[model samples]
Target: MASTLNTQLHSISFAAFILQEIMGNPREDETPQSRLKQVGMMSVLYIMHQGHQPLTISNLVEITKLTRMGVSEVIEPLIARGMLTETFVKNSMGRGKARQFAISEEIFEKLQSFQMR
Candidate 1:
């Protein structure tokens, strides 16, 4: 979870966003699967922004009730896009650390200020 005390899941309408100025207007060049992937990525971002705990892959899987592979697919592109970041959190026992994720601060700032076109 990454949405803290004041964090809330902000609504992002994929259909509306795609129809707007993103990528300089709707692309006739893009594929349906690509668009779907965009939607999935946005959804994961929304969840990341709204959570209060360190978001782990397992957490995403549990939250989405999706298989690990499915969640991994959604997260990979976001990471590549620089929309998400991962950090290691050490265990209480000082053993191996776990990877936790959150929206990249830069991306989160942009998302916070974004306006629909």
Candidate 2:
């Protein structure tokens, strides 16, 4: 009985090893579309998750460590695609207004589906 149990344990361990090898390390794809969405989504999520407040372009730039141009590039496409909604907020600093960006639920759902596949 002990020998049989030992054999079964080894078989289970071997199966786990095989499964890990087959699965490899799951990494996000760096395709252009995926990369854009990833940066945008992560930046949005980080702000929402951390700040629990509205997000501005400057907020996104700070959170994502992306340049103003980079953030604008990603945001323009998202706006054109209707994947995000933007609202202008009065800047307390009194220099210029800021735009708060939110991801549309429709786009969020689509991204979730894409990640599942």
**Winner by TM-score:** 1
> What is the Cα-based TM-score of model 2?
0.50
Cα-based lDDT for every prediction: 0.59, 0.57
Q: Model 1, residue 5: what's the lDDT?
A: 27
What lDDT score is found at residue 24 in candidate 1? Answer: 40
lDDT score, candidate 2, position 101: 77
Mind giving the per-residue lDDT tens digits that candidate 1 earns over 22-61? 3343346555575466566556655565555557777777
| Candidate 2 per-residue lDDT over residues 1-117, each given as its tens digit | 987886555444433432342234323433456444544454464446345756677877777798987777667655554646788878869788888877566644654454356
Alpha carbon deviation, residue 42, candidate 2 (Å): 5.0
Clashing residue pairs found in predicted model 2: none
Candidate 1 weakest ten by summed lDDT: 13-22
